[model samples]
Target chain A: MKKQIITEGKIYFPLSETLKLVIENIMKRLTRALLTMSGIVLSIAFYTTLMLTASALKYTLGAQQVISEYYWWMLFLAFLVSATGITNSVLMAVAERVREIGTLKCLGAMDKHILEMFILENAFIGAIGGVVGFIVGIIAAIVLNASTIGISSFFAIPGIEFLKALLSSILISTVLSVVMSSYPAYRAAKLQPAEALRSVA
Target chain B: MGGEASYAYTVEVEGLKKYYKMGNTIVKALDGINMKIYRGEYLSIMGPSGSGKTTLFNMIGGLDRPTAGKVFIDEVDIAQLDAYELAWLRARKIGYIFQTFNLIPVMTAYENVVLPMIFAGVEAEERRRRALELLDRVGLLKFKDHKPYELSGGQQQRVAIARALANNPAIVLADEPTGNLDLETGMEIIKLLKELNEEREVTIITATHDIKMLAVSDRIAWLRDGKIQRIEKRSEVRFKVYKVEG
Candidate 1:
């Protein structure tokens, strides 16, 4: 027998269930997911390459060097472009899934759950892009500086400093992706179920 | 009307109105409509494209707010509930089926069936058991792992029907459930819904353009120009099919 209808309290999916959905969604659209992650990957790789090259140079020369401001400005521009790309990609994704979102709403999903799903999806992409970009940057730095710094110098950089750079790159990419995805996520969550259902494609 | 205090009506709509403004003119989608639906009844709302069947369907499902008036589901005014409470109501009491068979494209048939139960916070074990049972009932247990795109239109609709019954809702709202199906498939869906309605004793309300639904519906409400033109019981209504001779 069906239970009596009661209107009280909020409905929330368990985190494990939500994570599974996020993973499944990403996996199903692997091509689009990879396309969206490309912006993060390229930008993070560039940023990491610049930072690692500078660290390698400083370590090889045994000098405390001050990086130029123009480099910082260029890095900022790269991130700006990457953020724009991610935001545009995520917005399109939300628009494409308007009907899906409506179906979810009809099945009793709250705005918060929708928000969490999108955020987690982008965060997962960000993490993957961050790690991949960091590895690429590490390889690029080694190839570029190996001949001049005698290969040993590249590895001679302090372990703590190398770990710090990796952590920072990952943190930056993840934060950038999340921040960029917020507006699209918010728009998706605030969609009225009725209008969303009526939307075409 | 007797003075008995029995709450036989499962849904009630009072003085409902919905208006949309298109530039200088106003379109009254639903105008001063009122209705009462009994528990365990099969009711069909039939209308043309612009007759506001979808609008009234949305209002009753709590998917859209009315311009005025009240919608009482199980004697509670839906507009009075907050967002969280409304979600709870939708999750626990109402099941909706759409013409397009809006199962999650990324999920398999089994996952789609289990989704509503997840929102209703059913235990993992119970959800799995019920999902498999519902799949078996729908005669799609073998195709449980197929995604929406992999299934045929009829198969997808069956999956959607099973998903709708996941949480054991008291009311199932179907909007053009057979709009995308052929005559044979549409009949199969209608029969399945009829059987489920009788077996589960759930209130089934459908907004459709299909005249075939009249055979299964206990009561049929005809809407025209944003208002109920007439409502008739199955016994009182008559049909005539005209065949064209070449």
Candidate 2:
């Protein structure tokens, strides 16, 4: 015998039903994040490519500048630190889940669910990217820091917190990016389902 | 209040007045419409362009409020319901099927159908069971994992029907559900709706401009210029036809 589903006027579906919707939605956002940041990623790759072949090869000041403003390879690494990749990845991820955002509202997803879904989706994406991006950025930075540039200097790679700081900085940027893009997500949530369901193209 | 009939109506509306201020002209979308819909009936609402059929449908679905009337569903005066209560009412009792078959494109067939239950705060296992069961009933168990774009228009409409029935609501408010489908597919969909009406005693209220819908409806409230021109029962239609011929 199937149990009575409704008691006291509340109707319930399975918990995973909503969770799966949310999970799939976040995955969409994550894909978008990857796309949105591809430019930045390409820029980093391009800049690294240039740095690898620059005239500063063999100069300490040149390499320091690479660490400072020019490449500031530390910047991506830094942002990834607190939770690196979070900001960029979250922004991209939420952007990707645009349709899901509107659909959830139509399904009568309350403000909290919409908010939690986007935040959690991107946060999960960020967390994943944070781990991976932090590791990669560190390796890149260390390779940049310790390797022979166009110029050479006595190089020191800290064994511990250097890694922590690098991870932390990346974390900050990821967080900042996520915070910045949340308004867009909320705006997407605020759209009338009637209007939002229209062809996005 | 409208005059009482012998039987209680599952839906009742009175003095419904809704308007939108478009620049200087106030569009009186629904002006003083009093309507009652009975249970275990399949009804269609038909009107020409600008006749406010969709507007009335929207009000009935609780997607919007009537600016100057009360909408009562199952005896609760919905106009008095707060935003949250309205939301709850929508989630619990009313099932809406749109003209476009607005299945959440992001979700698979299984997830889309159970969406309302999630909003109403159902548990996980039960919703999954019900969603699959409905999908199975609709003969789409094999296609449960497919997304909206992956399905044909007919399949999508079926999915929309399953979604509408997600809450097991007594009423289904479908707005031109077959408008986007081809003739053969549209007829198939009507057949499905008829089957549901016969099997479950579910009240189906469809708003359409198509003459085909009128043929399938148990009764029809024909609207012209936002006012109901006539309300005709199927038997009444047959009697009228015979009288005109004989």
Candidate 3:
């Protein structure tokens, strides 16, 4: 007999099964996953380092009045490049696993389930990459601004400001990762299992 | 079961047609076909490469939509169901075994078998128990922890069979189950499938080119040019052995 439970008007998979599948798939290709996530890590690290350097320069050069539109444009450019990198990596992942997706579908996975798998996989990558990037960025920021702020002064930034910066950087990276992977995840979800099987062979 | 309209057959197809557009010309993969698969019977569909055997199997398994037809699995017309409904049908009623032994490469044999149960949302403890039992049934219990690459082709196919039975599906659709195995291993797989048919009364529909599969089936249907050419009962099908010299 078939059993079903609905919560908040949506079908739910058992948490244990979902976690197992996600972890197994990710671990299966650890090297590739790490390579893909490196793109996000590098991009976020670059953006964070640049922003921190600018902040230190603003204080050292007494340029508080020099806040300008070009700063925002540069930030925009950094974010755009990161998004493109994430999209490329995610789309390549989808292409590589067409057969795997088809196999899941044949085992009774719905489009929503497939989409959830992809999104959750990338979200994990984002979380990890973001935290790693923030850690590296902090170190880079300190090293680059040591001459201007002095090593001791660099460590004296207000606790709240540092916390705020850390949280913002991680949040932005995670959000960008999700948004960039959305289209590719949707494409993976929309694949026909039969066609996907035939596509690979 | 009491409220639903019932039929003696596990699967029924009426006026099935599948056409593919290839440049200017349309290829008729399955054209104006009709068939019924009775409950608990072993049925084999034999055909040439382009004869639409796989297409027919796809329609019955709810893996593909027919351009013009109705596929009734246990009296419910599958074509009328939405994607979610079709998924439920697949999970609850139809199991599939592919020719290439399509086990997820990274998953252990046990994990592969448990996957269908997961999709069906079976309880964790129950799923594990059933998966192990199924592995034992297919004589692959010892290989439960091995990944697909670590197993022989025959062992991989056994794992696939165990996976197919994970959800206790009413019908198992096997497309060329023995096509990739050696002669002895192919025979063993066929015997195991026959045992499943006889002991559990699980209806089996296999599409294959293997002549030995035909001998074991309760009935065999031959197809050519997208149509059923003939269907013969096991006793009526005459098998003649021939030797070829290279």
Candidate 4:
């Protein structure tokens, strides 16, 4: 005896099982998820703050000529470290769930389904971290710039610069997350069901 | 199609061989074995620890490819199919039960039961209905919302059984299904499996060392040293069981 979820000719609130699985998986590892997010957050926050400070100082000190073009190297380094962090963390998560993947395979789940779950999980993590990092980075940039120069000078800085920094940080974190997860996702998809069972047995 | 029209067996294995290469030596897990399992038959494969019973079970379940042989399930030659075709066949035809009760730890019993249905493209309402019925049939309806960690060993195995039956598969392949449970709980599992086999006429093939399973089986296949030692009808299988006093 089960309650009917459909009314009339239409169904009410039909959710795909994959979406539920992805959400449940992420929620189950909230502590590890948060730890993984912190890496992205810290990296993006540093990148934003550095960019904002350079723009603010350019106007305040009228020293645009003194700004080094090699400053982009620091940003590149931050991006590389953050991408590596996401890859390692997602790989560890996949390693712990090898048997679960095998069970899914035995139950008829295709490689694409397993791949989709991992990508979606990392994308969500990246988005949340990016937004939070943007806010924190902007605030830090404003506070430090104000203390270094006068509050009036800080307010004089163009709003466009902050918007650019916001978009950059968010885009970088989200894209990095997806790119970094591909290898581990492929590895998970390629796992043989029998071998996976033995790994945990 | 003409060739398949004459076969009466649901699963037909011919000259199946599986060998694993470890370092420099090749271990013959299943050597030149052949088997035929008919529809609605309860067959048990019994053997000691390294006797290749599991290897045979894997070959029939489409979980592993044999070195030199063919497995035909429901008239389709599985060895001829590619990965995609094999996945489709496995999803639509076979249900697997493992000793470790491989239910997703984060999902509830109900969700675990409906997982295979979801893979088979069953709609939400139908999937829910079937999952509920299977859980109730397996006597795990009361624990539908519980996670695997929250359930007892017997309860978890019951959940796994319910999950196995979710897709209404052509066959259920159980590998040492009672290996991890107590004797009393194992008996309960056997009773449930027996009821399922009789009530639904689902083909049940189990690989195990548990003598209790032999009682309920229609045919028992004994394997030793990578070869089938003997196959006996249930009426011909006679063995003594002695209880150990604690």
Off by over 4 Å in 1: A1-10, A146-150, B1-6, B240-246
Q: Please give the lDDT score at residue B96 for candidate 3.
A: 87
Which candidate number maximizes TM-score?
1
lDDT of each: 0.89, 0.66, 0.81, 0.82
Docking band of candidate 3: acceptable
**Candidate 2 accuracy as lDDT:** 0.66
TM-score of each: 0.95, 0.76, 0.91, 0.90
DockQ of 4: 0.31
CAPRI tier for the interface of model 1: medium
Per residue, candidate 3 scores C-alpha lDDT tens digits across A42-158 of 767766676666555555565564436775687678778778888998898899888888888888889988898888888888878888887788788788767866666554455
What 10-residue stretch in candidate 3 chain B is worst by lDDT?
B237-246
What TM-score does candidate 4 get on C-alpha atoms?
0.90
Flag clash pairs in model 3. Answer: none
Decide which is better by lDDT, 1 or 4.
1
- Please write out the lDDT profile of model 2 over residues A180-201, one tens digit for every residue: 4576557655554443443352
Ranking by lDDT: 1, 4, 3, 2
lDDT of 1 by residue, A74-130 (tens): 889988999999999999999999999999999999999999999999999998899
DockQ of 3: 0.39
In candidate 4, which residue pairs get closer than 3 Å at backbone N, Cα or C atoms, i.e. clash? none
Q: DockQ of all candidates, in order?
A: 0.53, 0.23, 0.39, 0.31
